[model samples]
Target: MEKLKVDGVSVSFGDNEVLRDVSLTLMPGELVSILGVSGVGKTTLFNVISGLIRPSAGRVLLDGQDVTGSPGRISYMLQKDMLLPYRTIEDNCALPLLIRGESKRTAREAVREKLPEFGLQGVGRKWPAQLSGGMRQRAALLRTYLFSKDVALLDEPFSALDTLTKSSMHRWYLDIMDKIKLSTLFITHDMDEAILLSDRICLLTGRPGTISREIVITEPRPRDGDFALTEEFLEYKRLVKEELGA
Candidate 1:
């Protein structure tokens, strides 16, 4: 089933065009990544799909319903973790539920039950300051998931972490995704990270960014550490590099 679709989406800032006729779709439970160079308007495409910015043209569809220019229909996680410093991690994760009129106790209890899954056991009551960057991201993702479980639009959610931590989080994220089964659309400049996490990758290229290539990573899910060093991985790197003119 097609969970989400962006058909011929275009966005512009006055006379400056950001994205032009970019289109992509997410099948139910599939994880797709957008790979692009800086200033290619990947975020603008994301903003259009998430309905934060109305597209200059085209349609945004969720489950066959036309939802263009609508917000609150999909979950969007920006580059930052954006967890409230004053709130406990549990409270932070529960904020989405709370905002939807859930009782504080119920929200916290719901969040508490999933703390271990968040890799946050014994840390839920702790402040955001007490946790590592990876943990903060996990919490933020949990909060995003709470907002909309159907689809998640993630923008470089792991870019801040060091290589080692990011690697671990990639594994954790894939595992969590299997259990939750949410369709995901993410944008990342890291070729390896994109190849590692995505089932397929859509390349956004040019001044008015368009999805120029959609590369399917035929490798099985939850790839091992050595997958990046394999011939298939190298081929993906080669193809992506060619697409980017890098």
Candidate 2:
């Protein structure tokens, strides 16, 4: 069964029509990328999916049930890690469980048990400011996972890190996703990042953004680090560029 579905969604803010008939689906354990240039309604689409913004038209469904305009149904992470500097890493990650009615101690314990799985072991008691950029992202992702293990809406979550850190986080994220099998839909402007991390890429284009193309990456998951340097990867990139030019 499809894990999540965006069915013919459209959004408009007064005179500005930001999106039109945008639709996509995520299967279990699938990583899908929304690829578009800036101001192309990528974030707006995510907002609709995350139920923060009810689409002017269309339905958002999770596991076949309509869940449009309902917040807290899917986990969402923005470009920044958004970890609290004052809170301990453990507490930061435990926020989700706590919000859902778990006691503080239980939340901390649960977060600790899952820390090593996320490449975070001994940093639970440390401040967010004390960790490197990559580690902070790990913490943020852990928090996101704790919030909702079913699906995640990531908006350029790794875009803020330096090149090396971003690359490292990419590998880690793929490995973690392999273990957890969380259905993921993310937005990114970086072509390379989209190709490197996605199972399929949805091209959002037009004055009022719509899914102009859906390019499947058949190369397989946990793709080789050097895959980006290959002809097949270049072909996919070329196709994306061609579609964008249309």
Candidate 3:
């Protein structure tokens, strides 16, 4: 596992700045969430970290090596699953391996063995349209894991799922994350989701968004379904709301 650091980063498009002096560290095996309202540059910050957009200043470091402006160093999953409609689920999940020059036979074999763990056993032959929203996300996440085992950048991955489906996904994700040893830095507007899933929550605020505060969740992982109803959870939510000026 590798540590990801966004050090003193800033981004600007012409005279309009999107982010400024943003710095955060994603420790190995840690799940960190960046929370803010729309248009606050959460996604912009992610792009900087993922090296899709080079920050105007500062640097992105992975395991102590500078990787700013470089793509493919870390796995990135957006809001949509982005699975090709014509491809079978297995083919979609095996894309990372294929891109790395793995033979078709080898990639397929690897996906088959790993499918059950992501709760998509025997569905590899099906198309993306055949799966439910939650199932598609599981496949997407598994694909992300295959790309880079060390770290993943998720952008509201479960936002589209219904309440029940999202709840189920939350539990399943936490369980598999431990087994897979994948650290994550995800962006979410949902305070509840942030509190439930994050080891620490970075509250991005102000125009030209910055890390205004980082709220840590002290409760242990694998929290029960009722954890959200607890006072501690509510308190965390309150803190975030206050920070975001909600």
State each model's C-alpha RMSD to the native.
Answer: 1.0, 1.0, 1.1
Per-residue lDDT, model 2, residue 216, is 94
The lDDT, on a scale of 0 to 1, for candidate 2 is 0.91
**TM-score to true structure, per model:** 0.97, 0.98, 0.98
> Each prediction's Cα lDDT score?
0.91, 0.91, 0.92
Candidate 3: 10-residue stretch with minimal lDDT: 71-80
- Cα shift from native, residue 229, model 3 (Å): 0.8
Per-residue lDDT of 1-246 in model 3, one digit per residue for the tens? 349998999999999999999999999889999999999999899888888999999999999899999987877887799999999999999999999999999999989999999999889999999999999999999899888887989999999899999999988888888888888998999999999999999999999899999999999987767899999999999899999999
Pairs with backbone N, CA or C atoms under 3 Å apart (clashes), candidate 3: none
Candidate 2 — which pairs collide? none
Error of 2 at 61 (Å): 0.4
Expressed as tens digits, the lDDT of each residue in 88-121 for candidate 2 is: 9999999999989999999999999999999888
Point out the higher-scoring one by lDDT: 1 or 3. Answer: 3
Superposed model 3: Cα runs more than 4 Å off: none
- The regions of model 1 sitting more than 4 angstroms off are none
